[model samples]
Target: MRIAFIILLTLFYSCRGVSQSFEGAWKGDLAVPTGSLPLHFSLQKGDTWTGTMRSPSQTRLDFKLNVIEVAGDSIHLQSAALGMSYKGRISADGEHVEGTFRQGNYTAPLRLGRYDSTQTVKRPQEPVAPFPYNVKEVTFENTASEVTLAGTLTQPKAPGKYPALILVSGSGPQNRNSELEGHKPFEVLADYLTRQGVVVLRYDDRGVAQSTGNFLQSNIGDFSRDALAGLRFLKAQATVDSTRVGMIGHSEGGLISLLLAGQHAPDLKFIVSLAGPSLPIDSLMVLQLYHVGKSQGMSEKQLAKVRPINRKNFEVVKSDLPAPKAMTQLLENMKSVGGASGTLRKELQVMLLEPYRYFMRIDPVPFIQKINIPLYAAFGEKDVQVPAKENQESLVANLAGNPQSRIKTYANLNHLLQPAKTGGLQEYYTIETTIDPTLLKDIADWIKGL
Candidate 1:
């Protein structure tokens, strides 16, 4: 995990009224048009504030907004770490705040209010780099598609043809930077790998950064195509040893890597599955649903009722019926099978519906069984997005009949390969840093051995 820099962190220091008491631990939900998410605001006197957000499922984590600018009752924060900026206003009593979060022209209104602090505390001492990676970034074109893929291709300073790896981001329209909060994991990985005598190709996904395409409208299949295109791009490069080219995929990217391996691409040499799931899409999605509900303190009985509804609704949406009609009915049934009366229900609805449909419609088994490449699958035991046991077990079982697959489960690493306590996403924001160095070493060593 590369430590992204804080461009600004002062709470309205640039504005008047330097005496307001926006100096306590404030917590609330960021109420968006689609749903609500837990937003934590920790304020320190002298114009310093840190913000962290968690998804409804509480698995995906975001970063703490650096350089918070608060003016009187208004707050302005810009996270260059994520190339995002936000502006909102708080009530005089420090009770409520409403503002818009902006990334380029994409903007969304966020509502946050004060709350009681939980037992969770920030761990500033956790192991992480004090500064982000230092590397040269470059851009190249996809000759076949005419799409420009921006990347930071890092190589060892010494002149030599090094083994190369392409870094593929997980779900979401990620830039080549893999900008999580403000941290750029891909940039950091490229630098670290290059320093270890491994060349790395980290590029923007389609529809993100300098790449051309509509990322929001893309699916796993489209992402897979993009990954294949990346592999081809790397293979054609004069500096990259075509036979030594491999892929390092995170989260959904890991699953795609499995599919790529299964396809048995002739140029592919190795694959690293980081927190990838082997189970069917529907089953994995249901597990995600349950995990999110549990994090929000849902009761066992409530989960029992909600779980079946989730699985069934997804099944209905994936049926051969028309998509528009199926989606309409799915929403109706979700509304009927309700949970407690509050923000959680709305959040859960968003969590259960979108990704469930996305994953269920595709199957990776056919692809998983057909691969002839050297396979490496690993997971953080603490990962909540795709639990270690369920994801790795199914993956191992599929590879059980295939003798070439190798698997490892890290006990203390999170989805980002960061050394973590319980490996939860919350730790990502609360702890300042990139992933553990050992994990990086493990990856570098594995690539070298190949």
Candidate 2:
């Protein structure tokens, strides 16, 4: 995960006559309109006060509150890299730091207390040790790429030729657990599925955790090859019913399933998609950006200025122009429209541009139309990243030729399939439930039916 560099940490330093006991761990939740973000601060006292802040849920939030000032009861910390300044008043009891977190024209109330890891929301469904199912730490080869992938294969103890599912993760580098904010959604899902007479393969992404190969160089197709390798490995196993093997993927993983289904090889019995985009990636990305900005209360006028710049950038990538020429055109267009300024922003743009070029060009309609296997596609009604309405409409429209396709939209669910009000990515970490129970049951039953 790339660091946002836009810091949201608030800390408190000791004022003269205010207790030295105030200088330890401090934590706060920055409540945005979408959801709450947890901030952890570690303070050390030397000749001066120094501290680092961490956003446990997001890796992009590793920032130090180096510039700190303490005078009387007031504390000031500035991180220009993060484009924010925090000014808070430490309570006399040295318990809380009440402050206003300011960045640009936006200001929000921030309250920091003695740091507590327990403030993290609970995930009740996460599995514990001594599980009823047997779990094996297995390693398999993505024979096409010569990369060895490591993952946990979970199956029921009494299993005999059990139906199996390969769990594919979303975008970004993720572990076998698919861990985020102390929640292991994949672990929970795998456990739930395995307990219900289904075997599951949940692996780390390429170059992630124990897995090998350079993840930065891989596109969606590379990941699908890895997943297909998992399927082949499972098929050879005596305990797995090769004829009933299916692939279930989340987000980009879901898109990978579509890519694999078109192959019609290894005889994929079924495929399940969770919040997969049905439209072309370029169109989906445009809507995704718009939805996210709107959810965060961005004005339509502001969107009008930004949307055209985003479209032009994608167009340049899609064009026949050389990389240098495309980049020049993209930057010139951004400058002309008064959008995406600064050295940091431009550097990030260039860095991310190449990695998504293949994804941006993927046309899923052809893939869906060619798939002969039974398909179960689920979308969260409130998902902004892959809007439920647009994706579902496209899925039904494109897969109309496929008589075995099943498409559904879950109300009040977000991109993560957690029950949500706003469907914002920010809300993902805050919600206690990882994947909704009904959704899990729906997926399991569909796979079983196939």
Q: For residues 289-326, what per-residue lDDT tens digits would candidate 1 score against the true structure?
A: 66655554567776676677667765774566565667
Error of 1 at 102 (Å): 11
Per-model TM-score on C-alpha atoms: 0.70, 0.77
Leading candidate by lDDT: 2
lDDT of 2 by residue, 1-450 (tens): 111111111001232225234477887766332123456666667899887777554443568886877777777876666667787777777888777777565455566778554465678888888999898999999978999999999989994789998888877666787776677889999999998889999998777667899665677788888998888888777788888998888888888888788767565788999987788877776777777777777678766667766666666665667677776676677565443443323332433344556666777878887778889999998888888999888888777355667888999998888999998766876899999999999888877776
Assess the local accuracy of residue 358 in candidate 2 as a C-alpha lDDT between 0 and 100: 62
- Model 1: runs farther than 4 Å from truth? 1-136, 142-146, 335-358, 400-404
Error of 2 at 124 (Å): 1.1
